[model samples]
Target: MDTVIRMNRRQILTGLASGSVVAFAPGCVENPTLGRSQLILVSEEQIAQLSAQAWQQSLQRERVSRDPALNAQLQRVGRRIAQASGLGYDWEFVVFDSDQENAWVLPGGKVAFYRGIMETMENDDQVATVMGHEAAHLAGRHAAERASQQQAAGIGLGLAAVALDAGDVENTAQWAAILGAGVTFGVLLPYSRRHELEADRFGVDYMVRAGYDPREALDFWTSKAAQRTGRPSVPEFASTHPSDETRIAALREYLVARNYI
Candidate 1:
């Protein structure tokens, strides 16, 4: 529901249903959640369901390596970051048996890392940088925000996005369920670019609080972006984060200001 229409400036919308067409506002459409149909269509439960389904599908299709060593390292980093956010622990870190270089942290402290990305991290600090960024997305509640924005923009829940499965997803994820191996690799891995950058910002702060060198975070992302640049990440609208350069530049500025560099 719209509290007010503020395309440029905030204006009070009195009542359109009252038929009192003589109010102060001439060029405004009055929208209210109390009486009007909820234009913000999706519920928190729906978003959660959708994301959870998608994530669930994702984990099952991929080969998950239940490697104790890798899981511990990832959890260590993820927890360090999450703990700083004042969110309690019950963190689950799973390493996927895949070549794709990506990682994700679901809401409610679920974290995952691909074998390829973990191998690329030269040290725990570097891995911590990546983990911090991913955790930031959940810590900052970026996914829920993205879903809200998507609903507001009239983009319905993604076809393969997180929603309750009418039937059943085989294995991997209980949420963020990607349906097929092909789609998981090609489609679901990326997030909206805005979500990506916001994660970066959140990640930077987490890495610092976790006692990792924040300056290296940029290089960390740069390395990942460079690897996938020629392939071109999914288009912006479909993606959850910004392109690599934009993310790098923003972080560069913020980190420099924060003296994390």
Candidate 2:
């Protein structure tokens, strides 16, 4: 009985790895905001449902700050950017009471900013810098595209695993793990960096449209780069985000081209 169960599991894995698993045909849809076509395997409704769950989880997991000043500023900047985005995603912004210099956005316009990052901003224009960037992620439909890419990569990795198993390769588990890391660092991370750069460019555009000083975006990113001067740097290729210098340089070029500076 045990041997039968083991064989059945192996067969199932092998079948899946051999591309026998059924899935929707991948679709490339035009994203008007980004001016590009994106591979979107999942529906917007599905991504929104997931985003709502994630938003709830985040509220439950993090210590939500009730600081009136912080909340007010976040709302002020967030609304302008949201309006500029024109995505109409039922946008919600919450400030987490953390010292980590981090912020993130979920699909459907859910935005979270940490108190630490908020404190770093010297003025509303600086706040607008980050706000517009988060808004651009929604405008770009990045979450759905990222999920689709991962889904595709998973199937490819499964095939690699099955091939190794069929060949009776030694340390198949180790090889599979290595292959998974390769997909992450090589494929996914690079795409993430591209997304970051795209956001930076479009975020500045949103800032301008929302009546914020676009040059402040350059100042904000430059200060961020300086703050990281002493920290250990991650290689651009391996990191999920571009280096601060890379971001600042790109932002400067865009601002120049647009004559915003």
Candidate 3:
């Protein structure tokens, strides 16, 4: 039994390493800007198509801002960053008439910002900070890569269970819980934190190239961190994003490393 268990473990590890679990070269492609290879299961055309559907749905459900001043400001800042992004995406920036301090970007450069976040920004540099970050997610191919990784993980877990069964190992509730927690905290959450940091670093670079002050990025995040102190707390490992402290610290380190100040 001991020898059989050892053999099964070896087979599982060998399968994982030999591309039986993850075909490293298939869906993986090198992103020149991020200088990394990403697993992109979904094609750009599919993402764009889905984005268009989402954009249309949002337009129907959300009240778009007609504030002339806000519209003009968003357009001005968005154009500068879009030009600097070098991603060649057809960027569309819209301001939503809401008080939620939030912003998001869809694939193919569809971006929406709430009036709440806009009102909080002291300057266009702050806007550029967010825009650059969202754009970096796109240029970094994060959405597709995330989907692919999750899919692969699901498949791998299923295979792992099968392998364990073949080796006469029980897939008990405790084992399931342990494995689930390990995947969530050790792999998925950490990957998300890394994505956030990568976006932050690339965002700062985009801000600088777009003639926005990189210092404003730091200031903006610091202000956000202060705001979060009064809000409900979320554990870093349980959340898909890193804590504000972690993000801010990483941003500062990256800024200093790149001499962005």
Among all candidates shown, the one with the greatest lDDT: 2
**Pairing residues by index, what is the TM-score of model 2?**
0.81
TM-score leader: 2
Q: For each candidate, how many residue pairs have backbone atoms clashing (under 3 Å)?
A: 34, 0, 0
TM-score of each: 0.65, 0.81, 0.78
Ranking by lDDT: 2, 3, 1
Candidate 3 on 53-129: residue-level lDDT in tens?
55666677778999998899899999999888887888899998977777777778877887888898899999999
Candidate 3 lands at a TM-score of: 0.78
Q: Write the per-residue lDDT of candidate 2 for residues 66-147, one digit (tens) a residue.
A: 9999999999999999898787778898898977677777777878888888898999898888888878877888777776
Higher-ranked by lDDT: 1 or 2: 2
Once fitted onto the true fold, the runs of candidate 3 whose alpha carbons sit more than 4 angstroms away are 1-25, 155-186
Q: Pick the winner on TM-score between candidates 2 and 3.
A: 2
Cα deviation of 181, candidate 2, in Å:
1.6
lDDT (Cα, 0-100) at 81 in candidate 3: 92
